[model samples]
Target: MSDPDADDREGSVPEAATPKKKKPKKKRAAEPSAGGVAIRAVRLSRWYGKVTAVSEVSLHLGPGIWGLLGPNGSGKTTFMRMIAGQIKPSKGELTVCGEAPFANPNVLARIGFCPQEDSLYDELTGLEFVSAMAELSGYDRVSAERRARAALEEFGLEDAMTRKMGGYSRGMRQRAKLAQTVVHDPDVLLLDEPLTGTDPSSRHQILDALQRRATAGALVLFSTHVLPEVETLTDQLLLIARGQVVAQGGMDEIRQLLDEHPHHIRVQCERPRELASRLMTAEGGIVGLSFRGPDVLEVHTWQPDETYAAIGRQVLESGMKLRSITSPDANLEALFHYLVQRANRGSGMGADAGTGAGPRLQSAAEKAAYEAQLDVGGGR
Candidate 1:
C-alpha cells in the first residue's frame, strides 16, 4: 500500500535504515513537530529465524482512527508490537512522535498499548488496575485515581469501576483494559482486537470513545480482522495481507480498485427470461446475465446503479412482478478478498501467502474472527 506522504517501498533496496541515533540517559519524551507525522516507518520488517512476519511495510500515519486490517498471521500483531516498543524490528526504521520506541521509555510513555491477550490480576479492582497504569505512566497517586475513574466512565464502565476484574464479564473486562490504555492519555494508542468479546452496546460506546480521542488530536490505531468492526470505527484503513499492505485510503478508493470485477445483482422476478432479454437490448451497462431458476435472474454489470435503475424502469413500464433483489458481492468480505487476490503475490491467499486460514491461527480470537467472515452458504 502506498500512502499519500510515504515513499514507495514495495521492492527491496540497497540498505535499510539504522536505529539508535542517540542514547537516552533518562525517560525523556518528545513529540512530533507541529503538523508533523504521528508515526512513520520505512522498510519496516520483523522475522523469526528464516520466516519473515512483517515485510517491507512503510507508512506515514497521522492523527485518526487507522484500522490495521488483515487475516490470521498477516503480522498485524507483530507490526503493532514493534510500534509499541515491546519488540525491536529486525530491519527498517520506526518512530512514534519523532522518537524511536524500542527500549526507549520516554517514547513508550507517549504510547498506550492494549494487547490482544487481556491477562488481568484477578484480585485487583478495575479502578485499581487502571490507576496503577496511570501511575506507571508518571501520574501521582491522587491524579492516577482521578484519571482512572474518568477513563472508565469514558468507556462506559463507571458502574463497574469498583468491581474486581475477575468477577466482571468479558465485555466489562475488555472495557477495563481499554480504560487503562487511555488513562494516561497517550499520543498514540495501539489496540489489538479491542472488540473481540464486546456486545453491540459496548461496541458502540468503545467506538465513540475512540472517535472522541481522535478528534482531540490523538492518533488511535487499532487492529481487527472483522470488517464491520473497522467500518464502524473509522474510514481510514491500512489493509495488509501475508505481511504486506494491499490497500489503503477510504472506502471509495477501495471500491474503485475492484471496478474490473462485475457487480452481481440477483433478482427474483415473475419472468426471468423476459427481464434478461430486455436488459440485453440496453446500452453498455450490463456485461452478462444468467438464469438461476425459472423465476430468478442473476445479472453481471459494470455499473450496478445504472443497471438496477434500468431494470426497475423496465419492470415498472412492462408491469413485471419483481419479488426481491440483492447484491451477493457487495460486502466487505468480497472486497477484502478481491484486494487480497489482486495483491502482488505469486501464490494463493493460503499458508504464507496470507489472508487464508489453512494453518496459522495463533489464538482463539483469531479463529473466531476468521470464522465470522466466512459466508454461511458460499466458498471463498
Candidate 2:
C-alpha cells in the first residue's frame, strides 16, 4: 500500500514547534462498568468537497480491544483519523475520553495513533524514530529513549533498532511503526492495520503487546479486513461497509442480527441427487436447493441445526453415502457480505448490481476444501 502521509513526512514538523510539556498526566477516570462507553460518536460524518468518506454514523465503544473491519476504501481509515484528532468531522460529534479530539492537545496526548501507511523518517534509525515520537508525546529525552527501546523490544524489533528505516523490509518497517505508537503508553490506541506485512512471530508479539495494553485499561482499536486476524485478537468488532457502520458487537450478537437471512451450505456426496431429493421432501427449514454438479448440492435453510439433523436422519435411513458438508456463510466474511448486501438493498441500491461491492472471504477451511477438491481432480 502507498503511504498516505508521504508528503507530510517529507515536510516534517520542527522539534521546536512540538507541543510543550503540560501538567503531570492526570489520573484517568475509573474504568467504566460493564457496557460503559469509552468512545462515542453521534451522527458523525466526514467529507472532502463533494466526496463523502464517512456518512452519518453513531457508535459507542468500551475499553477493550475492538476489530474495525471493512473492505478496501470502506472509510475505516477516515473514521480512525477522525477519532485520532487528525481531522475534524464535517458533521455531528465525536468524542474520545469524554472530550472532542479535534485540536485537543490533552486528549491527543492520551491517544496513540498507528496509521495504516508508512510514516517513518527513512533517514533515521528505528530507535531514533521511535524516540522522536516519544519525545513529541511529551517525554523527556532520557525517558523517551528508554521507552523507545522497551517498545521496540516488546515488538521483537531490538535487533533492527540501530538499522535505518530506509534499509528495513516491509515487516520490519511495520513493527517500527507499531513500536512508536505505543512508546508513550497512551490510554487509547488507534492502530490502522498494525499487523500488515508482519511475520507470524512478529504478529504474535504485536498481538500480545496490544492485549497487555487492553488489560491495563487502554482502549485498543485496530482495523483490518482479514477475518482470521480479527478472530485471533478480539470478539468485539465494529463492521463498516460503504462508508457506514454496518454492525457492532460480538460474533454471536452479529449472527443473531443476521438470523433472518437463510444460511447457504454446500454438500458433496456420492449420491447428491438422492440426498437432495430426500432432504427436500423431509425438511421444514430448507428454503432453496440446487445442484452444482453431478456430485455437489447447494442448500439454503433458515434453521441450519434442524436441517443438519434432518440430513443426518435421511442419510442413515436411506443408507446414502455422504462426503462432506460445509457452510459458506458461517464466517465473518459471509456476515460482512450479508450486511453490505442488506444495506445496499435498503438504500434502493441493488445489492450486487449498482456497486461492484460484495463480500470477499477466503477462510482457512475454505482454502483447505479447495485444495482437497484440486487433489481429487488430479490437479494438485
Candidate with best TM-score: 2
**Candidate 1 colliding pairs, count:** 0
> What digit string (tens of lDDT, one per residue) describes model 1 on residues 1-380?
22211221242211221121234354233343433437776557899999888877656677888888878888899989999999899987788888789988778778899989868998999999999998898765666787798888878888989988999888888999999999887888899998878898888888888888788778888988778877777777777777776655565555665566788899999998998898899864899999998999999999988998989988897798999998867566777777677554444332322222224445878645544542111100
* Model 1 alpha-carbon miss at residue 153, Å: 2.5
Q: How do all models score by TM-score?
A: 0.75, 0.79
Off by over 4 Å in 1: 1-37, 290-296, 303-317, 322-330, 341-380
> What would the TM-score be for candidate 1 when compared with the true structure?
0.75
Error (Å) of candidate 2 at residue 41 is: 0.6
Candidate 1 overall lDDT versus native: 0.75
lDDT of 2 by residue, 1-380 (tens): 34322332475423533443233254233233422226777557898998877876666676789898877877899999999999999997788888899998777777889999976788999999999999888765766777788888888888989989999999999999898889877788999998889988888899898898888788899998678878878877777777777776776667766666787888888898888888888865999999998989988998888888887898788887889989877677888777777766675221121112122215767534433322111000
